[model samples]
Structures are given as structure tokens and as C-alpha cells.
Target: MSSSLLIALILLLSLLAYWLGCRRAVTLAQRPSADKLHSRPGYYGVLAGLWCGLPALLIVAVWHLAADPLLTRMAMHGVAAAKGVASPDQVDLLVNDMRNLVAGNVVAHEVDPLIQAAADQYVGLQRLGDLALAAVALATALGGAYVLLGRIRPALRARNQVERIVEIVLTLCSTFAVFVTVGIVLSVLFESIRFFQQIAPADFLFGLKWSPQMAIRADQAGSSGSFGAIPVLTGTFLISGIAMAIAVPLGLMSAIYLSEYAGPRFRAVVKPLLEILAGVPTVVYGFFAALVVAPAIRDLGGLAGLSVASESALAAGLVMGIMIIPFVSSLSDDVINAVPQSLRDGSYGLGATKSETIKLVVLPAALPGIVGSILLAVSRAIGETMIVVMAAGLAANLTFNPLQAVTTVTVQIVTLLVGDQEFDSPKTLAAFALGMLLFVVTLALNVAALYVVRKYREEYE
Candidate 1:
């Protein structure tokens, strides 16, 4: 049986087990001489279901993990016996062929009779394994239900058992998240170390030029690429700064207006419309930047007798700013509205104006959250690539002038890894280093934001 079908069957059995267990518990309670049940009837039902499902689920998991590699090994052994002394790559190809034949895909290479026989064996073994798995899992689940039902006395702590199982599952989920984060950090760190070994930290970190093209051979054209990352870093910050400049004030003002001045009906109509900007895809924004915004900016600059690159930081930054406005406005709106009503009432009773009260009492109270929102917006702006790629040109010019063409770390990382490139090359490795840098920058922003939040957080209670 398919795993999905088997799971559905197990679930149905568990439901039956739940009903029986509940009915038996109720019967025992109604008996003249029986003690009152230790826990609720629903707890008994849940305990029975856990017993029926958990063991069978474990069996399915183990079989699913182990069955594929085990069957592949056996199949590969058949191929090896038939075609003596093949390389590891050849063995893998033959194994793939066996799988393709079984799955009815067109085999890419010539198929031998021995390989065909092995493919047939693979199909037979897989079907047999799946059948055996279904049988064993269902039997285990049924047996567990039988045992648990027999043990379901009036004094059984079904509630405690169920709670313990839930606790373990939650703990596993939490630990898994931590492990995943640690794995990402370690993988990036290791790759970055390899990158830094090939290029000096001083050169990559501080040098002005940003060229990453390394000659494959000594005779190849172009100077063995400049690994200096300063230009990319500069462009990233310039665009992000421009974005934040446009986003923070406008977003904060919008939040203030929505929370303090706008009536409920107006707020309802406008807030969702404002937030619609956030839902727009980045690629759509990219197209807007490239097609509409860049041209407008260039025309404006030309009218003022200034040179503007077709793909300039100003165009990308403006679109990115528009994209991040909702994040700030929404977060700040919530934070501002969360201020205690009593604070505002007290300020009003003291003869303070609404504007004065907001500036003195409400804003100070919501400052931490506002700061957090801006930081989040800044981070979003920094990490944006599609708009930057489509709007800003990929020339890594180290300049802060918004009218000039520039590139970012993310853009360069994408550039470096676009085609079939050798992993060991400094060019490819540089992408990892840039990635690590971006990671560190984002981490630092989070840390700084946390520190600022804690420092400025106001306790109302």
C-alpha cells in the first residue's frame, strides 16, 4: 500500500480505538462497584489513539529511511556481478538506469539483459518491501491498541501519559529549529574560511576594487581578479540608506496618522490598501523599477542638466523603499496602538494637547517597537536583490552618488555562481564569503536592535 493510504488506515483504526476505549471507560464507571475514573473520558480516548498510532508511525519512519539505500545496494550488487569491475560513477549510472526502467522512464543508454533482470528484481523488491511494511505497521498498531485497551483501568493516568508525549514532541520540534540554524551558520562559516584562505582578508575586506574574475589558467586574459569587496558593501549600504531615508519618516507618519488621527472607518479603508504594497511581488517591483521608475528619474535628472545612468541606485532604492513602507507602518501602528489608554487619558487630564501627548507619552512608550520596525525595514532593504538586479546596474562602482550605476553583495554573489563554475576557484568561493558577510551584517543588526529595544523598553505595569 502507498504510505498515504497506510496512514489513513492507521488513523481510522486509531479513531475506532478511541471510541472503544471511551465506551469501556464509561461502562466501568457506571458499574456499581467500580471506582471513579482517575481522568476524563476524553483523556482515555486520546491515550488509546496515541497507543494505536505512535508505534505504527515509528515503524513506517524506520522502514522509509532504511529501505531505499538497502534495496539500492542489493540491486547494485547484481549489476556488479553481471558487469565486472566498474567505476563508482558507472555503478551509479547503472543504478539510475534500474530505477528509470522500473519507473518506466526512457533509458538513456544501452540496456543489457543482466541490467534488465536487475531492474525487474528492483521492482519486485520495492513492491514486496512496501507490502511487508504495510502489513507489519498495521499489525503493530492493532497489537498496541489491544494491549492498551486491556490496561485501560479506571485508575490509569491517561492525561499524564498524553501530556508527556506532547511535551516530547514539542521539545523535539524546538531542538530541530536550533539544530537547523546552527547547521546553516557552520556551513557558511566553513565555506567562508576556505574563501578567505585563497584571498587575503585585507584584500577582500578593505581593498577598493571589486573584480572577482580569476584566470582559469596563467595564460588567460584579465588580471587574476580583484577580490576586494568594499565597492559591493558600499553599494549595499548606499541603496539601503536611501531606502531607509524614504521609508522611515513616511511610514512613521502614516502610522501616527492611522493610529491617532484617522477615524475607524477611514483606517479600515486605508490601512489594508497601504499594506497591499507589501503583498506585491519583488519581481513586479523590479519590472516597475526597470521600466517605469528608472526612466522617470533619468528624465528628471536630464531636465536638471545632470547625468543619470539608466540603471541607477536612486531608482532601485526608491522602489525598495516603497516595498518596505508597509512593514514599518504596520508594525509601528500596532506598537503605537498598544500604548495604555490610561497614559493618554492622564496626559489629556493634565491639559496636554493630543499632539503633545503623543510626542511626549505615546511615542516614548512605543519607541522600542518603532526602532525595531525601522531595523526590520533596513534589513529588508539591505537584503533585496531582485529590484537591485533589475534596476541598478551590476557595475560594482564604489560611489555613494545615487545617480551612478552600482552593484550589491547579493548581486555579485548571484553573478559569481550563475553558470557551471568550479567550486574551488576563488571566484566561486567569493560568493560564500559575501554570503557570510551578509549573514554577519544581518546578525549584527538583530543584536543591535535587541540591545536598543531592551535599553529603551518602557514598562507600563
Candidate 2:
């Protein structure tokens, strides 16, 4: 049976166990000589369900993890013996071909009689393993349910055991998440180190040119590629700066108006309308920027006798700012609303005007949250890929002029890793280096934002 079907059966058994446990608990509670139950009948039911499902799930997980590799190794050993020994790479290729054939996927090479027989053997082994797994898991679930039901009584600590088991599961999930994050960071860091070893760190970091094209052969034209990240980094900050300039004022003002000045009817009608921008896919925004905004900017620049690239930073930044406005406005509104009404009342008691109270009392109280929201908006802008790719041309120009074409770190990373390229090449590894740089920049921004929040955070009794 498939894992999903097996899991479904286990769950169905658990439900049956829960019903039986609950009925037994009720019967015991009604008995004349039975003492009061330590926990509720529902708790007993839940504990029985946990016992029924958890051990079965654990067996399924462990079985799959251990069985797949063991089966693959056994199949590969047969192929190696039949094929009269092969290199590790050749053996891996054969293994892949065998598995692909077994999975009904396209194989890179023609399947001979030997590989076909091996594929059949592998399939037979998998079926046998799945059958064994299903039998063991189902038996374990039934056994656990029987044992727990026999032990369930008035004095059983069902709720305590259930809570402890839940706590352990949550902790395991949290630890897994942390490990995944660390693994990603380490993978990127290692690849970046390899890239820097080939291309000088100083050159990659400080070079003005951003070409990453390297020739496959020594005699090919343009074999030397520049890996300077300066232009890309400049474009990133310039576009993000323009986006922030447009977003911060508009978003903060709209938030203030919605939270403080606008009446309930208008606020309710308008808030969702503004937030709708956030739900629009970035690709749609990209198309809008490319088709509508970019052309309009170019025309306006021409009318003003200024040169504007067809794809400029200003166009992308403007649309991105519009896209992220909801992030700023929604969070700021929530923060401002959370500011104590008592502070406003006290400010009014002191004869301060509404504007004065907002400026002196409410705004100060909510400044930390406002800062946090703006920081979030800034991060969103920096990390945006589609709008920048569509609106801003991938020229990687270092110019600060919004009218000029530019590219960001994310755009370059995408460009580098677009096709099937070998990771051993500096060209491909450059993506990881750029990724590491972007990660550092984002981390620094978060650190700065945290410092600002801590420095200005307020307390009130």
C-alpha cells in the first residue's frame, strides 16, 4: 500500500480506538464502586488515539527512511556484479537509470536486458518492502490501542501523558526547522567560499563591471568574465531607496488618516481596498510596470528633455512601492490603534489639540511598530524579483539616475542560474556568492531595525 493509504488506515483505526476508549471511560465512571476519573472522558479518548497513531506513524517513517537506501544498494550490487565492476560515477549512473526505468520515467540510455531485469527486481523488492511495512505498522497500531484500552481506568493520567507527548512533538518540529535553516545557510556559505577561491574576493566585491559570462572552451571568445558585484548592489539600493521614498510617506500618512481621522464607515470600506494591492501577484505588477508605467515615464522624460531608458529604475520602484504600500499601511494602522486611548485622553485633558496629541503622544508611543512596518516594507522591496526583472532592464549599470537602466542582486542571481550549468564553474557559483551577499545585507538591515526599535521603545504603566 502507498504511504498515504497506510496513514489513512491508521487514522481510521485511531478513530475507532477513540470511540471505544470514550465508551469504556463512561461505563467506568457510571459504576457504583468506581472512583472519580482523574481527567475528562475526552482526554482518555485523545490519549487512546495518540497511542494508536503515533507509534504506527513512527514505524512508517523509519521504515521508508531505512528501506529505500538499503533496497537501492542491493539492486545496485546486482548490477555491478553482472556488469563486471564499474566506477563509482558509472555505478551511480546505472543506479539512476534503473530507478528511472522502475519509476516509468525516461532513461538517458537505451535499456538492455540486464538493466530491464534489474528494474524488475527493484520493483519486486519495493513491493515486498511496502507489504512488510504495511503489516508491521498496522499490527503496531492495533497492539498499542489494545494495550492502552486495557490500562485505561479512573486513575490513569491521560491528559498529562497527552500533553507531554504533544510538547515533545512540537519541540522536535521546532528543532527540525532550525536545522533546515542552518543547512541552507551553510550550503550557501560553502558554495560562496568555493566561488571566492576561484575569483578574487576583492575583485568580486569591488569591481565595477558585472559580466558573469564565461566561455566553455579556452579558445572561445570572451573567456574572461568580470564578476564585480558593485553595479548590481548599486542598482539594488537605488531602486530600493526610490521605493522606500515613495512608500514610506504615502503609507504612513494613509495609515494615520485611516486610524485616527477617518470615520468607521470610510475606514472599513477603504482599508480592504488598499490592502487588495498586496494580494495582486508580482507578475501582474511586472506586466503593468512593463506595459503601462515604463512607457509613461519615458514619454514624460522626453517631454522634459531628459533621457530615460525604456526600462528604468523609476518605473520598477514606483510600482513596487505601490505593491508594498499595504504592508506598511496595515501594520502601521494596527500599531497606531494599539496605542492606549488613555494616553490620548490624558493629552486631551491637558488641553492639547487632536493633532498635537497625535504628534506628541500617540505617534511616539507607536513609533517602534511603525519603524518595524517600514523595515518590513523595505525588505519586501529589496527581495522583489519579478517587478524588477520586468520593469528594470538587466544592464547592471551603476548609475543612480532613476531614468537609467539597472539590475539588482536578485535579478543577477536568477540570470546566473537560469539553465543547466555545472556548479564547478565560477559562473554558476557566482549565484551563491551573490545570495550570501544579499543575505548579509538583509541581516544587517534587520539588526539596524532591531536597534532602532530597542532604542526608542516606550513603556507606560
Candidate 3:
């Protein structure tokens, strides 16, 4: 069972035990004052339940996360004391090799007998941790019940204890998400730093080329791939801008129509149709871009008397815009609906027409939420991979014209790490650097969006 589910089962069993104890107490004491006895008895049951369950569950969570890395560390130390591997790099290499062996992988060198033994020890230690934790949790829950049953007699303060336990349990659940997000950010931050060591920060930030080549064989072709991200970033920004141009007006208008204008029957049909865009696989969009959209864009450019590449930015951008329309519309609609109906009634009573009330009152009230949706859309556009990978040319063009071809950070990251390649090369490391940049950029977008939503929400309130 998942640790979470096991924890839940333990808590549930404690609750059941508390209920049985409380029911028995009530049956034994038949006094009228007993119905009023000790905060209605149910409170006593819950209090006992919380006392039995909460502490051990917290320990289990801490144990699960700490177990793997701790055992790995122990295994690393074991290997360090072994016969062959002595240096730091060698230790790291041995760890990786041992990991591969456990997964039934072929290692670089013939496997050392001692290192293999150490790998077995790590796995065994992890199993032991799991077994020990389960035992401890069961023991603690049973022990807690034994104590709480004694305290369940009349005159004990049970309701307050139950409430306090509820508060702590809720806080623990909420903190879990925050902890996971922080862990991910720290992991990415460290990996990115390792990558930046291979290529200078300034060079990566300012360089003009992006062909990351591993010079494995003699006389590898092409100028060493420019790791400079400006061009790809420009492409992402340009295409995302184009996408927003198409999506915002179209999606928002559709949202306004659906939420404010469309009848129930029409909405029932159209909302699903709009969301169907989201359900469509991006890879399918890629195919459509390559087969249908690219040619159509090229022809339109031809009619406009402008030279356009077969694989152009306009095609990818438009397709991406289509992909994101449902996201913006769905979010905007929910935010608009969340606005108070009394505010709308006041606007209408003041002789505001439907359009004017919606524009001036509802939109202003929902502005923060709308801006959040747009920021989310912008982030989605930036991180989008398959459509850009197939339709937009892989060449990183520094130009701004939407009619011409351009690449993006996500696409390049995909190409950089697509095949079998050495992890030590600048090419591979560059992917980490780009990923870090992408993460940072998205993090900023989300922060800005949330800030806008918070400020405006306060204004509305």
C-alpha cells in the first residue's frame, strides 16, 4: 500500500476503536446526566481517535521521504570503504554503476563483486525501514488507544483535543503540497548549477549560436552549437505573442458569449466543443501543422507578397494559440461567474445595458482572475513542445518576422536530449541549463499572475 493510504487506514481504525469505546461507555452509564456527560461522547471518541493516529502518521511521512536517500548515503559510505573505488568522482561513478546493476543494466566496466554487494545492502535497508515504520505505527496506534480509553471517563476535556487534532491534520495535508513544490525547485536549481559550470553563464546568456555537439567521432560537422538562448527565447516570445493575439480576443469573447449570452442548449454543446480543443493531443496538432497549416500559412504569406518559409513561425504560433484557447476561456468563465450577482443587479438597476455592465462591472471585478488566466496561458505557450518541434524550423533565427522560421527553448531542449548521448557533454548539460531557465521563467509568470489575482481580489472584496 502507498504510505498515505496506510496512514489513513491507521487513523480510520483508531476512529473505529474510539467509537466502540464511547458506545460501551454510554451503555454502561444510563444516567440522564450521562447523555450530557463529557461533551456528548462523540467528541470523546474523536479526541481519542486523533490522539491514537496523528503522531505516528507524521512519523511515517518523515520516514518515507528520508528512507531512500539515507540508505543510499549508507551504501555510498560502504562503497567508499570497499577495495577499488577511492576518489570522489569514482565514488559517484560507482553509485551510478551500482544503480544500473540493480536495474539489470550493463555497466561501463565489469561489475565489482564488493560494489554489487553494497547495492544489495541498500535495497535491504530500504525494505527494513518500511517494515520497521509499519510496525512502529501499528504499535503506537494500539498504545495510544490503551491510554485514551482510560482518559475517556467523565470530566475529561475531549472536544478541545479533537478540534486541535483536526487543525493539525489539516495543516499537515496543506503543508505536503508546499513541501513537494519546494523539493522540486531545489532539485532543479542544483542540477542547473552543475550544467552552468560546463558553459559560462554569460556565454549561455549572450551567445548567438545553439548547436550543442558531442565531438565523439573525428571532424564533427557544424559550428559548435550556440548555447546562447536569446534566439530561441525570441522565438518562444514571438510565437507566444502571436498565439495570445489570436487566443485572448477569440477565447475571451467566446467566454463572454457562453457565460453571458449563449442559451443553455447552445452552451451545453459549445462548451464541450471548446474543451475538445484541450483534449486533442498536441502531437496531432503537430501533424496538422505539418500537413495543413504550414502550407496554408505559406500560401497566405505568398498572397501578401511576403517570402515565407515552408516551416514558419506563424503556423506554429497559430496552432499553439488554438491549443490554449480553451484554457483561457474556461478559467475566465469561472472567474467571471464567481463575481457576485448582487453587483450585477446594482449595475442593471443603475440602467447599465448588459454589454456595458459586463464590460465595466464584471470585467473590472474579475480583472485579477483574468490576468491570472492570461499569465497561465503565456506560460503554457512558452513550455509547449510538440507543435513547435514539428512545424517551426529547428534553426534558431534571431529575426522577429512571424512569417519566417524560428525555434524555441522547449523544442531545442527536446532535440538536445532526444537520443543516446553522453551526460558529461556540453550538449547534454545545456538541456539542464535551458530547463532551469524555463522553470524560472514559468515560476515568475505564475507568481505575477497570483499577485495580480490577489491584489485585485482584495480590491473587489
Candidate 4:
């Protein structure tokens, strides 16, 4: 069974068990002071449900995760040994084929008797596993309920115990979010460390070239690809520059108009209209960039006596800017609206025009938020992939010109990993290294933005 289906089945059964348990517990004996119970009957039902599902879910999760990989490995090893395969790597390929067969993903014409046998074995084990899981789960839930029932005497602090259990479960669930982030960061860090073992981290960070290709055939000497990230970062900055050029003025002005100038009726309409820019799918933006925006820019540049590549950084950046504008304006608009009414009145009372008061008082007061929003935009631009892939050229040209074709780290990472490349190859490793760089850059931007917002924020009236 799929993990999700397993979970759903377990939950459905647990809920049913909980209701039955709750009914049994409540009717076990009628208390004269039943109304004096610490919690309502529904809370008791929820408590029963929690006890039934939570521990069993935890046990199942731990067991499946720890054992599934081991089982798969043993199966692969057994199949390999049976096939008399000498190279472990060759065995792994056969194992993949076997898995595909079991999944029914392989075409019928290609299905051999060996593959069919493996698939049958896989399906058999899955059925046994499901049956075992169901029996164990039901038994555990009943056992827990029976024990809890005996303890639920009139004097027992059942509510307190249930609440404590809930607190622990909630804490564990929340910590998974932190764990996921740390896990990703650590994986990238370690892989990047491995990559740096092959190439100097300094060269990767600051060198002026970024051709990540390595030869596939064993004795073919060719141009050594430099890991200098200057071009990718240069292109990243160029794209960001063009995006910011498009986003900042437009977004900030929109915010100023929305917050300080627009009346309520206008605000109601314009805010969502501005935010609608954010709802457009990034892939749609990518298509627009490739089909419409890039060609228009090239033609426009040609008319203006400037050479423009059809897949220029400007087009992607501009489209990305449009994507980021809502992020900037919405955040800045909130901060602007949060400014003290008294300050605006004071500025106006000093014989300042509405424009002067807004420019001087409101904008400066909300400047920190604006800066944060801009930093967010910058990070978004750096990490953007689809638009750059479709619109920005693949050439890792270290050019400052927005009209020129250039590439970013995300685009390079995509090109490096896609297709049937060996995982141990430099081409694949380059992606991990680029990912580390991207992580560091975004991390720095986030930290700076948070610091700026915190430092300048008017926290109290």
C-alpha cells in the first residue's frame, strides 16, 4: 500500500476504535458526580482518538523508514547474487529494472518471466505487510484503551495526562519543520564539501569562469572546465539588476499610492489588482518571456541601434521583476499603513503638501520594510529557474549588459543534472556546489533583511 493510503486507513480505523473505546469507557460505570468530570465527552473522545493513533503512527513511521531501505537493499543483493553479477554497480541497474517491473512501469512487451516473478514477490510481501500492519495497529489501540480504561477512575487526572501527551505530540510535529530545513542545509553543505575536495572552494567561489563540463571518456584530454562562479553570479546580478530596475520603482510607487494616496474604495480594488501579479504561475511568465517579451525587447533594441539577444537577461529579469513586484508592494504597503497617523498629521500641519508629507514621513518610516522586500525580491530573482531557462540564454557569458545572453546558478544546476549523467561526475557535483552558493547568498540576504527590519522598526506607539 502507498504510505498515504496506509496512513488514511490507519486513521479511519483508529477513529472508529476511539469512538468505540470512548463509548465503552463512559458506560463502564455511571458516576453519581459525572458532571464533575474535568473535560466534556467530546474531549474524552478526542483523547481516546489521540491515544489510539499517535503512538501507533509513530511506531509505524519509525519501523517503515528504518526497514524499507534495508529490505530493498537485501532484495537487490539477493537478486544480484542469483544473477552472478560481479560488479555491484551492474547489480544496482538490474535492481532498478526489477523495481520498475514490480511497479508495473515497464512496458508489457519487455516483461520477462524473471521480472514477472519479482513483481509477484513484491506484491505478495506488500499484502502480507498490510495485513500485519492492520492487525498490529488494531491490537495496540485496543491494548492502550484497555489500560487507559482501568486508570480512568473518578479520582484519576485523565485530562491532565491527555493534555500533556498532546503537548508532546504537537512539539514533535512542529520540530519536524526545523529538522527539514537543517537537513537540507546539511546535505548541501556536505555535498559541497565533497565537491570542494575535487576543486578549490575559493576557485569555485571567486574564479572568473564557470564551465562545469568534465570529460566522460577515460583518456580524452580537453579544456579543463573552470569552477569560477563569477559568470553565474555576474549573470545573477545582471538579471537581478534588471529585475530590480523594473520592480523597485514600480512596486514602491504603487505602494506609496495605495497606502498614502488611494482612498478606501480605490484601495479595495487596487490592492488585489496589484497582488494579482503574484498569482500568475511562474511557468506562464516563462512562456511570456520566451514568446513575447524577449522578441519584443530584441526588436526594440534593434530599433534603438543596440544589439539584443533573443534570449537576453533583460527579458527574464523583467518578467521576474513583474513577479516580485507584488511581494515588494504588498509588504511595503503594510508597513506604510502601519505608520502612526499622528506623524502624517504633524507633517501636514507643518504646511507640507500631501506629496511632500508622504515622501518625507511615510516613505522614510516604511523604508526598512521596503529594504526587506527588495532583498526578498533579490533572493527570488537569484533562485528563479523557469523564466531564466526558457528566456535567459544558456551561455555563461560574464557580461553586465542586460541585452546580452547570460546564465545564473539555477539554470546551470538544471543543465548539469538533467539527462543520464553519472552521479559521481563533476557535472553532477557542480550542481551541489552551485546549490550551496545559492543557499549562502539567499541566507545572507534573509539575515540582512531581518536585521534591517528589526533595527529600524517602530515597535511601539
Using TM-score, give the best candidate's number: 2
The worst-scoring run of ten residues by lDDT in candidate 2 lies at 106-115
For model 4, what is the error of residue 404's alpha carbon versus the real structure, in angstroms, after optimal superposition? 1.0
Q: List the residue pairs that clash in candidate 1.
A: none
Writing each residue's lDDT as its tens digit, candidate 1 over 226-268 gives 9888999999999999889889989999999999999999999
Query: Mind giving the per-residue lDDT tens digits that candidate 2 earns over 274-307?
Result: 9999999999999999999999999999999999
Candidate 2: where are CA atoms >4 Å away? 107-110
lDDT of 4 at 391: 95
Clashes of each: 0, 0, 4, 0
Predicted structure 3, TM vs. truth? 0.77
Each candidate's lDDT (Cα)? 0.92, 0.93, 0.83, 0.81
In the order shown, what is each candidate's alpha-carbon RMSD? 2.6, 2.0, 4.6, 3.6
In angstroms, the error of model 3 at 107 is: 7.0
Q: Write the per-residue lDDT of candidate 4 for residues 1-461, one digit (tens) a residue.
A: 55677677668756875676467557643666454555545556666677767766876777687655554664454666666788978866776777787676885576656545665676666667767776676677667655655555444555777789889878988899889999998998887877888888789888998887777668977666778999999998889888988899999999988887789999999899989989898999999999999999999999999999989998999999999999889988998888899998999899999999888888888878889989988888888899999999799998898898999999999998899987666667889999998998899999999999889876548
Which of candidates 1 and 2 is the stronger one according to TM-score? Answer: 2
lDDT, ranked from best to worst: 2, 1, 3, 4
- lDDT tens per residue, model 3, 195-306: 7887789988888766676575557764455678888789989999999998899889998998889999999999999999999999999999988999998898889998
